[model samples]
Target: MYQMLVDLTKPKTIRGHVDVVERSDAGTVTSKGKKKKRSRKKNGRTSSGVGSDEKLNQGVDESVDGCTIGKLFVSNRVIAMGSNGTIVFEGTYDGCRVAVKRLVKAVAFEVNLNLRISDNHPNIVRLYGTESDQNFWYLALERCTCSLNDLIQRPTVSEDQAKEVKVPKVMLWTDKGYPSTILVELMRDVVSGLVHLHGLGMFNQDLKPQNVLIFKEGPLRAKLSDLGISKRLVEDKSSLGDHATGKFSIPIPIQIVYCFNPIAQYLISLAVTGCGSSGWQAPLLNELQMRAVDMFSLGCVLFYCMTGGGHPLGDRLECDNNIVKQSKVDLFVVEHIPEAVDLLSCLFNTVAELRPKASEVLNHPLFWDSDTRLWFLHDVSDRLKLEERKANSDILKALESVSSLAFGTKWNRKMGRAFLKHIGKYRQYNYDSVHDLVRVVRNQLNHYSELPLEIQKILGPGNEGFDGYFRSRYPKLLMEVYKVMHQFCREEERLNKYFKGSVV
Candidate 1:
C-alpha cells in the first residue's frame, strides 16, 4: 500500500523549468508565454460553470501546459473536491510539489488560521504561501500521498504482494486489519499535532481520518490538515461561551446549498456545524466548548484506525444518535489490545475534565514497543517491592486491583519442578497476592535465558521472549501496574522524584 503511494506521488516533469507569471484575469498561458483565452458558454458564463463563484480557468484549467496561479503551477488534475466548493489540485510551488487548495468563496479567517498554525511543525501540514485573484483564493500546502481516510479504506494486500514485501518487525498486518504498530504511530503523530495546537491555545473542532494526511516518505508520517473550522481557545471566548450556553449558529455558507447533491450537502452541513463530524464528536460538545472535545474526537478516530473503520459508538448512521443517548461503545474489536482499550476508555470519558490532555495521550504505553513496556513494568515492580511497607492508599488499591486480576492460580506450574526447586512452596502459587504475582513475573523475566529449554518454549519464541509471551496472555497486567504507578506518583510528590525521567 505504501509502495503504491510512493509510485503515485513520484514527481513527473509536466513541463521543463517554467518561470512564474502574473495574470489579471482567469486564463491559461502556454509554456512559451502566450495567453490562451478560456471558452465561454452562450449565456456569457464560463464553459465549466459548476458554481457561481467557480471561474473556469482560475485554478482548474484543462491546459496541456498547466496554469500558473501566483508562483504555483496548478495541474488540472483534481486531487479532491470539498462540499464547500473548494478544489484541491496537484501543483508545483517553487521546485517542490504541493497540494493547491483553491477556495472560490474564500474565507479570510481560515487562510490566516492556516498561516498562523502550519509553520515549523512536522505533524501539522506546511503552508508554503497563499495567492488570490478576482474570483478565487489559492493556498499551496505540503503535498501528502493520501488522506488517512483513503489509507484506512484501502483493500488489504494480496498473498503474492505480501510474500514479495518484507514487513517490519514491529508491524503486524493481518487480513483482519491494519498493523497495530502503524495505527499507534500514526495516532501518536495526530496526538503530537494536537498537543502543538492546544499548546498554542487552539482547538481543531473537526478532527477525523479525512483531516489526517499521510506522507509516505521514509516512514509513513501522519500530519493534521483541514483546520478550516478550528478556533483559537483564547480569542473565541464569547463564541465558546455561547456554545456552552447552547446559543450558537453553524455558519453554513449560502453557496454550498446550490452546488452539492442532497447527500453531500447533508454531510457538509454536519461537518461545518462547528460541533465536529457526527460520529467523532463528544457527547457534551454543545455544552462544553473546551480542548477536551478534540480528545473525544481523537478517541473516535483512533478507534476507527484500530478497528479498520469501525466506529466505537456504532456505524456512521447510528453514531450521532448513540452519542446523544450516551450509549455504551462497542469495543469488541480492540479487546485484545488492552492498552488501547484503557487509553480509549479515558479519552471516551463523558466528563470533559476527566479526558487526558494531548501530551498525556501521546505518552500512553499503547505507542511503546515491547522492550520499553517490559522495562517500565520491571521498574514498577522494583518500586513496588521497595515501597511495600510504606505504600500509600493509592499503591495499596493498585496492588489489590492487580492481584484480583492475576493471570491464573497455578502461575508457576509451567516452570517445572527443577526451576522451582530453589524456592520453597512454589507448587500452589497465591493469585490473591500482588507481591507473589509480581515476584514470579520478575523472576521469569530476570532469568528467562537461564530457564530450561522446555520452559522457554512454553513462554514462547522470538527476540522478545517472555515480554511477548506475557503481553499476549495477560495484556492488562502492564496497564494495571501503570495505572497504580501513575496514581501513586500523583499522590506522593517525593516518590515522583524517583521517576522524574522515567519513560511513560
Candidate 2:
C-alpha cells in the first residue's frame, strides 16, 4: 500500500509501503518507498551505533499486573538497567509466583522484519494482556531478570565463576573454557526457540541482549522478550482498504509501528527502527530489510558473544563496497585475534553474500570443538591433495612443449610469463603440493566467476592482475600435451568401437 506520511524529521510528505499487501493494521506492513541506510561492521572496531535508539524508560507501572490483562495496581519499584531505569514487580497469578513487567511507554514497535507473536514459542516472551483505558497503555508480561546483554557487561569472570553460570551464546567465545552442560543446553534452547519462531514463518526482527531474557526464578531457561514490533505474515490484505483496521481498529498503512491489539491513532512520527547497538546488527541487514535484517542481527549477536561483548564491526557501511576485508573464509568462528578479526570482517558486511549463512555458521571452524576442528582440517587437506595432483600433471606437461600458441599477443606474452612466475611464487618443491595449490586456485576462481560482475568487481576476483592478463595461461608444453592426449583418447575409442576391443 502507498502511504504518504509526513516525515517528522524533515517535515515533508514521504511515501513507504508494506512488502505484503495488507488490509488491516495487524497485517505485515513494510515501507514502500526508498530504504533507509544500514551500517556495517569491518575490522575489530565498535561504536555507539549499537545502542543508538535504546529507550530511556524504567519498568514501573501498576496499571496492569502479571497474567491479568485489565488488573490495576500501584508500585514504586524501580531498578537500574543498562544506562536506564528498570521496574521489577512481584505478584501471584494462578497461585504461582510470577514476575510482572513495567517498561517505557511504547509509541512505536522496534524490529527489522515482520512477524506477529501471539502467545507462540516457549522461549519467547508470552503476552498475557494490555491496559489501554486512560493515561497510557501498558503491556502486561511474565518477567525475567537475566538479559543476555546484561550478563555480558561484566568485566571478566574466572573459570569457576562460569562453572554453573549461564552465559549468552554471543559471549561464549570470550570465555574460552567450554560452557557448562547446562549453559550449552540453555544456549541450544535459545537456538531451538529461534528455529521454532522461524519455522512458523515468524522473524524476531528485534534481537539483542536485553530482548533475550533468562528466567531467574525458574527453569534456568531463556526467553525472547519484546514484541512491540513483531509482524504477522498474512495473505492478501489490500482488500482492507488503504487504512485497514484489525482487531483493535488500528490503521494498517503505517509500516514501522507495532501493536498487540491497538486502538486507532492518527499517524504522528513514523515508528522508529531499533537495531540493537551498532555491533548488534548483522551483515545481512545493512538495508534493514526483513529476513536479511534478522540474519544480520544474528551474526552480530554471535560476534558479540564470541568476543565477550566486544564490538566487531565499527558501525557504518556504504552499500557499494568490497565485502571481504579479511583473509580466508573467516565468515564464521571468531576466536583469538584472527577469528574475531575474520568474523568481525564478515558479520556486518554491507553485502549479504559476504555474511555466512546459518548452516555455514553452525559448522564453522570458530564454533567447532577440538574433535570437529581436526575432522574439518582432515577433510580440507584431502580435498587439497586431490587438487594438487591435477595441478602437477598440467605443470609437467607445460614444461615439456614449445609453441602452438594460438592465444597470447606479444604484449600478452610478457604479461603471461610474469603471471606464470607469480603463480609459481609459492615455491613448493613437492609436485603434489604444487598440484594441490593449483586445484585450490581453480576452485576459488570458479567460485568468483560464478558471482555477478558487480559483486566480482567489489570482491576483486582475488585474481589480481592475473585473471585477464593471461589467456588462461598455458605452460606451452601442457597445451600440446593435452591436444595429444585428446587425440590419443579419441583414437583409442575409435579403435575399440571398430574392433570391439575393451570398453575401458
- Winning model by lDDT: 1
Top candidate, metric TM-score: 1
How high is the CA lDDT of each candidate model? Answer: 0.63, 0.37
Question: Model 1, range 1-504, lDDT digits (tens) per residue?
Answer: 657544333323334332332121223333322235544332223343223322322333445334555456666667677756788876656544567788874574455454455445889987776656667777777766556776666546554443232222234343434345676678888988998888887888789999898776578778898887777666545236445563444446644662454444334445445447666767654445457789889998888888777789887687776777677776778887777788888888877777887877777777776666766666666766656677475576666667545454445553446545543434454546655656666666787777778777866674355666666556567776776777666346534533342334
Which residue window of length 10 is worst by lDDT in model 2? 17-26
RMSD of 1: 10.4
Model 2, total clashes = 30
> C-alpha displacement of 23 in model 2, angstroms?
42
Error of 2 at 298 (Å): 1.6
* TM-score for each candidate, following the candidate numbering: 0.72, 0.42
Off by over 4 Å in 2: 1-74, 79-88, 102-119, 128-140, 156-189, 216-220, 235-279, 282-288, 315-347, 353-504
Model 2 agreement with the true structure over 1-504: per-residue lDDT tens digits = 213221111111112210111111111212222223223121212212122211101122223222222332212232222212334344322222234344444442221111123345677765443333333333334545456665665447664443324333243321233333344444544555655565555556667666777664344566776654544434522111123432123246642343321211111111233323333433222233444445566655655555456444442352111222211223333432332344345545566545443433333223323333223223333433433467455433442332334222322244334333443554432322322333333543545566556545543444532232221233222223223333333244322221121111
RMSD (Å) per prediction: 10.4, 21.2
